[model samples]
Target: MSVVDPGSTRGRIVAAGIELLGTEGARALTHRRVDERAGLPQGSTSNHFRSRAALLGGVIDGLVAGELREAEAVHPATAEELVEQLAALVELLTGPMRVTTAARHVLFLEAAHDPALRDRLSRDRRAYVASVVAVLEQLDAADPPAAAEALMALCEGIILHRVARHDETDPRPAIAVAVRGALSAPGDG
Candidate 1:
């Protein structure tokens, strides 16, 4: 079970933090702001998080937990299914999940300067990669791990472009190509 339940105070604070980060950037993520955003009493956020690093850590944990939950729902039985799933993921990230995606990008920049944050994010990323690798293995990819990495990179790029650059171009073609390439024989490509 996840430590941060969506209905709990801690989860509310974390969700507020993500919203703040997504809408107003990292500078606006203060305990007072989080408390206000969460519609809690003053000091509530500080009471739970204790420090800026702890608050950020809570946000990261919350994001990872939610992402893992979504990933757990994906189980592609074939290469084409993988492509469709990945394409839909891109659409979801760039659409309804846009705010969360923006918050993630903010954390990514912050992680560059914080080794602890970077480590935490890296650990979560490895978990996601492992899940993708499992799907690739099921589809009989030539090199599941490498292919998973490639697909992850490609999806990251697509998400970044769509979110940051506001590029509305379709991602299905690229996702299909990458999925097909990953499933191809090692020497056939």
Candidate 2:
């Protein structure tokens, strides 16, 4: 078998962690599993990540980057159009991107007792909110600052609702409806 380069092993481990986080979730994420999935020596995972919390931080970073990329890629024409864009985003998030959200929730829970993990998660969340704000500004040519805050609030609400429900059913439809309503309502400002 071909040997994986030491330089690339760190990235491979992170990628493998992301994949595992997406598929098997936080509980399934282990250093051994990451090393095995990346076809690296057992020490590779420990050498790079050092701790499970750090590895989880890397995975969450990847998820945040993906979310920002998706949000940045879409530019809608009007407020209604923006709501539609959010709907599509929610659908993708609750569908293909569900694992990312799931992992995020798991990380949040784990962070309760882990200060390092909590800090990493808080920073990641702030970045995500900023990205969402940027997208909201682009979508609504007027008063984007306010819209961004409202949008972020809406997103948080949706996440909380979904977490509370624990995937008994898809939360996208309800979240989309709530977002659309909020976007149309003026009181949110």
Candidate 3:
């Protein structure tokens, strides 16, 4: 099953790799598994990504790009607004995107041994943290950088907890509380 569109085929292969990584860990992220998961012919994955490293890099690229796009699409000017934004984000993390969350964690751990992947993950994490800082600044957070780091850590913890617990329902209430604590002001609402 060769795809006529090269770009779509690559995207599908990357998506398959992510799915496999999420479900079965790094050991299961073989070319054949990607092809089978993508519903493509045998060896198709190789034609697109020559090596496992390339495939893993593509998976990280796709994940970070999607997340960056999401961040750009949503902007909040208040702590309450940020919490409302987090409602949708919580739904995404605990719902259909749980596999993506799991795969991201897997790749993060793998990066410790792979410097190239570490650089990519580090760069992407910085971009994400910048977005969080922008939101924190808008809400007049006492310490935007620190607040952003804490919020990002909390968000990652949320994903880990949701993945391990296998609960798909929204975790907005917790997210709301964290945002409030991160951005709350004394003698002000």
Counting clashing residue pairs in each candidate, in order, gives 0, 0, 0
Give the higher-TM-score candidate: 2 or 3.
Answer: 3
CA lDDT scores, all candidates in order: 0.90, 0.67, 0.80
The candidate 3 region of ten consecutive residues with least summed lDDT is 1-10
What is candidate 3's local distance difference test score?
Answer: 0.80
Which residue pairs come into collision in candidate 3?
Answer: none
**Runs of candidate 1 exceeding 4 Å displacement:** none
- Quote model 1's TM-score: 0.97
Tens digits of per-residue lDDT, candidate 2, 1-189, equal: 123333487768867886787677677899999999889988888887888867776676666767767777666665556666766776567667776766666677778988888887777667666766666565543555565666766765665565445444454465556545545546644
Off by over 4 Å in 2: 1-8, 138-146, 156-189
RMSD of each: 1.1, 5.3, 3.9
- In terms of lDDT, which candidate is stronger, 1 or 2? 1
Clashing pairs in 2: none
